[model samples]
Target chain A: MENNLCIAGFGGQGVMTFGKLLATAVCDNTDYNVTFFPSYGAEQRGGTANCYLIISDREIGTPMSDILDDLVVLNQPSYDKFVSKLKMGGRLFVNSSIVKPTSDRSDIQIISVPATDIVVGMGNIKVLNIFMLGVYIGYTEIVPSESIWKSIMEKMAGKPSLVELNKNAFEQGIELGRSQK
Target chain B: MAKVLMKGCEAIAEAAVRAGCRFFAGYPITPQNEIPEYFSKRMPEVGGAFVQGESEVASVNMVYGAAAGGTRAMTSSSSPGISLKSEGISYAAAARIPMVYVNVCRGGPGVGVIQPAQTDYLQATKASGNGGFRMRVFAPATVQEAVNMTYKAFDYADMDRNPVLILSDGVVGTMMEPVELPPMKSDDEIERIKESKKKISCIGHPLGERVWIKPGVWDTIMWENINKDAEKLYESWADQAEWESFMTDDAEVIVTGYGIAGRIARSAVEIARGQGLKVGLIRPKTVYPFPYKAYEMIDYSKVKAILDVEMSIPALFLEDVKAAVKERCPISTYLRSGGNLVSREEMVSRIKKLASR
Candidate 1:
């Protein structure tokens, strides 16, 4: 089984980093094969930045897919650009605090998480990706929670205290997502 | 050991380190800037030297110098940057310097775009530099292959006392995937490798003996000798030509490509086969040697046609395919340029159309 995902947001929203973390976690912690393909160049100039990731049980031939099984967006433009490309019945996770997805697609599952509000409670917007990932795992359970926690800690290895904040942010997201489910 | 997921750029740099590359010199270019960025931090950690040359010319010459002194030296660049280094690359060939250079190719007759394109096939395999020099060029299809090819490139260079080129495109250079990294070589091993070159190395030798030619005097004999030796080395590389044949045994139509395009074609061929099409793939892992023998081994009686797919307009790689097939079958091309990828669906459709004809 191949799981294709496109995580997109404005620059500095940790979109690429989130995909990298997921790819790395799957590669290092599980038996799955993974590929992370980032979209570089002009779009990265303070504009919409994105990356494509594939986690598969078998060897992955292509790093990208035309239609993504999961579309994670943090802003409105990203939502507008990617919502139609999501596979029917695919999972859509949006940061509802900043992005209000106006797509009238009832075919897919949409989980609007108020990530900005939650990160605001933590007084840091950078942990927004960790919170979103927490919500992603809460719904999908692609990998276990401890695996993601370890991956996050390893990624933030040098910055010890920020790990604590990110962990807390992730826990809050997981709790919110569980209640919604 | 646990596997790691790494971008192609970082994996190559780390592979260079593992392969005992002690000196790296390069300028920054899109889709390949990560090589220098990783080397700048990594080389020093391993007690190696790293130079961010002001330009591609300076960078290649720096690598040439390091290779001459018996260090496993490498330089990486995109298309235009590689064009700038052509002169130094020629000098390295003339001097029989063993070095590795990576061309993370981008679309270009000129600096076209930063996205992946294989337009440098002719530039890399046919005429990398003046004086008719040839280097073994390995085109990797996957990230794991990229790592393996890069890790072994230094050895190939050292064995032949010539340059080895890893001709990757933007896709293979920037994409991230899981790879089982090679074991790192120790400092003692590096020193031993360097020490073996003390007899002929220019580092501590007399200026008269080490220089290729006298400063102001023309030396026709010296030029002939260098060319003759390079000619012999180039001919010896025929034994090392490598190719991959994917289900070509009983296939009627053979699809041929190199690098990432080849990988795409293999997948397309497999999918077409599931639909009962007799399509197969011949992918050249080593493009400079061109693997003509592999093409010649095809059963001409059963094969109906040959399809050459690449990410270049005018299809530079097709010339080699044509030469190998010798007009035994109708040859068709599926090509794209200006940083556009050669899509698998397009390849499958083209192969199917050719098969029907």
Candidate 2:
């Protein structure tokens, strides 16, 4: 019962990687069958990348999502590209560091966070993706926070020193979102 | 298992491997090249064998050699490449060797485009080989069907000691879909399959203990004896002939095609019906043992005309449908070629336009 999550951004924003981590964490920590698919257009290199995630108690018949339950829009172009397509009652977690506030919609949930700015304030620019991921976990509570954090550690276990910094950034992102709520 | 999304040619290759097929030889051609590519990678993983021959001609002959070696063997190519393999296909039939051939069809009677087409129907079903040898042809409309038929083709080939072709089209080949793979059969169960006219499996002989017969002797009494024995072997393809029927009982028109064309026709029929058109689709799953009987009992009076949609210009398959439904039902054709796919919208509109006529 997590969600059909989609992440879309520019070529190197780790848009696909964020989806992978979310899918992996949900599959490992929850009682769900999950699929993570990264699809791109004709360009093989330096083009946009989008990831499709379906985590459900039931089997996922198709590995793609036509209507997203959750969307992580990383840039102005991505937010503009996918904003209208978000399902009513779905959440659009915007990187407020880039995109400006638009018209308010009654049917949807909008969480505005300067995800990248927070991570940069924490003295590391590369951990913005982790910061954004931490926000999704905080709002949804779909999977246990401890498990997602553990998955991040396992994923980055190869680089031991970076783990503590990412965990701190993730915690800060969660705390910042909670403070606003 | 369950169905999964897969490429058409790769599905057939995977199914053949699952069926205990151990040898594959092929040269690559678009639309169907992934079959060889699939086996080239996956066959080794399963401890089977794969070899890319010098040409389509060479590949078919290698399949023959492997089949002659008593291994379940297969090769895939498009229309032009199949022409190159004709001599070997004919030889395999004449010599009565059991194997599978996958023809992922494209447009034209010659070097056509790289999209899906059903233009190769006549060459595949009627006769592309010498001495009028007939092969059992299986045409699948979906990727999973292609996979299942590839396995069935091997069994059918071995049963009849003849070639069984799984004729697929470009759309099915290129589209990726979800599919569940069948479990691998046990080695003992594989060995338990009765070898049919296997001239390759010679026991109790090692190193130079065997007698090497000259090539001339193989053509003479030895060849005749092999064929004679093959004639006595059980044919595996005889009984499996079927077609899928959808709402044809009160159908005023029967829309017919096979493989990708058939899939398109199915969607067209559904739309045509929603618009109050009493049209039904007759998808021929097999081309050789074509379901002539399925059309025989149709309410011909209601079925005033039959629209035959195809990826090739009118010929072969259209001709077959005409012959099958000739006396009672009038036939019409809508065609696109050079590997272009005719849309369902176009077909339904065409049927409506012709309905008054």
The residue-level lDDT of candidate 2 at B314 comes to 65
Model 2 TM-score is 0.67
Q: Model 2 - which docking category?
A: incorrect
TM per candidate:
0.93, 0.67
> Native contacts retained per candidate?
0.64, 0.00
Work out the iRMS of candidate 1.
Answer: 1.4
Task: Kindly report which residue stretches of model 2 are placed more than 4 angstroms away from their true locations once superposed.
Answer: A1-181, B194-240
lDDT of 2 by residue, B189-303 (tens): 5666624333334323567766331222445777677656544542333345678887799988788888877876876787688899888888888877777877886888787
CA deviation > 4 Å runs, candidate 1: A102-106, A175-181, B205-217, B351-357
Superposition error at A143 for model 2 (Å): 18
By TM-score, the best candidate is 1
For each of the candidates, the C-alpha root-mean-square deviation to the true structure, in angstroms, is 2.5, 7.6
TM-score of chain A of 1: 0.95
